[model samples]
Target: MKLLLDFFPIVLFFVAFKLWGIYVATGVAIAATVAQIAWLRYSTGKVEPMQWLSLGIIVVFGGATILAHDETFIKWKPTVLYWLMGGALAIGLLGFRKNLLKSVMGAQLELPETAWRAMTWSWVLFFAVMGVLNLWVAFHFDTATWVNFKLFGGLGLMAVFVIGQALYLGRYVKDGKEVPVEKP
Candidate 1:
């Protein structure tokens, strides 16, 4: 349910790209993202910060793509978003001594403070790497390839990361209960 909602914009963008081209695809993406936010707000009465950020980026970058008649701006959107998220997480960890990931998922998954910190750092690193990866692909590959990478590569990497995180935290899942424990 939530996963489908999350992918709605990307899927629409992919389809639009196949049928039309980057400009039309960008426009479709913008619309899909806006619709996603609207639907989420209507259904849940609240929009997540990430969703809002994504919406803003798509609107600005996609709009620029359309208005400027250039695809570079749209291509940089994912990298920018990724870097921003990583930056925010880094600030929370280093500046405030807070694990943002734990703050978000703590209610569902309990782990030792050390584990939480490790997970937070892992995510920070992951986002940073993904940002770089996006830019690398964008610059090296053609627009069509970059678009495919955006939908498939980005999502694939994220799925792998989440799966790896789940496996890493499996040890802490205590008989179907979430119990935070420190490693001695």
Candidate 2:
């Protein structure tokens, strides 16, 4: 349910793009993202940092795309978001005593420090790699192809990441307990 909610803006963006144009689609996406965030907050009384960051990126890049009359601005949106996340994770690993993944997922994941460290590092690296890949695809691919990749490819990568993470998490997760997520 939450996953579907998260994808609502992307779906809207795609539909709007098909109906109107890149700029209008981006604008609509930004609006949808904000509405979703507000709805989530009202219903749950909390929001994730990632969600807010994503919203910010959509608005910023979407506006840039509209203002500059170039899709390139929006194209780099993912790259910026992913790289920032990657850098934050990497920095957290280096600076903090406990792994960020462990802190967030420790409720269900009881893996050792080494495992947590590795997982955290993997996230950092993955996001960084995603950023680079987004840039490559945007700059090299055709406009339609880039849009498709931005929407479908990004979602595909996310699906793979979640599945992979579930596998890894299952290895050390306690027998039958749900993980606790921080919402702030």
Candidate 3:
């Protein structure tokens, strides 16, 4: 499924870290991301911009970690990517007066303009907080703790955030017939 495909790289990175170490994990992560992109391209006939950005960040930070024999670069990668996403969304909203979330999902979900802006800002704030939290864990804890946080804590928080978003947005559905899209 799409969720499994989306998480493949992170899962591989966790496994590799547990078996080997950060250096080996970094290599595995890079390879897995590359493979993910390739699979997406082959199946969808195109790669999303976010995927390209992730690949670029991993290669740059992971490559630096390998070449310099420093784990700091790899530790910074997640925070960098998170901040970039938040920044992009913020800029789209404030600079261009656009709600990117609405633009992307508007076809599927109809909602009022206020609800659209609220959702976009919610994601922006989430990304910002996540970025800061990643940095905090990366610096305050040891490698093992950081890796655990990255794999478990990060994913858990994301799942919760997404579920919360869906629930909140459901209240403002323009169709006036709210229904759960996924089976419980």
Residue 173 accuracy (lDDT) in model 3: 59
lDDT score for candidate 1 against the true structure: 0.92
Residue-by-residue lDDT tens digits, candidate 3, 114-155:
777888889889999999999999999999999999999999
Question: What's the count of clashing pairs in each model shown?
Answer: 0, 0, 0
CA lDDT, candidate 1, residue 47: 97
User: Which residue window of length 10 is worst by lDDT in model 2?
Assistant: 175-184
Cα RMSD (angstroms) for every candidate in the order listed: 1.7, 4.3, 4.6
**Weakest lDDT window of 10 consecutive positions for candidate 3:** 175-184
Clashing pairs in 3: none
Candidate 2 matches the true fold with a TM-score of: 0.88
The TM-score leader among the candidates is 1
Ranked candidates, highest lDDT first: 1, 3, 2
TM-score of each: 0.95, 0.88, 0.93
Q: Model 2, 1-184: lDDT tens per residue?
A: 9988988998998888888988898899999999999999999999999899999999899999999999999888889989988887777788776577777887755666766788888888889888988899988987778778878998899789979977887765555763443443
- Tell me the spans in candidate 1 whose CA falls farther than 4 Å from its real position: 179-184
Residue 133, candidate 2: Cα error in Å is: 0.9
Identify the candidate with maximal lDDT: 1
Candidate 2 accuracy as lDDT: 0.85
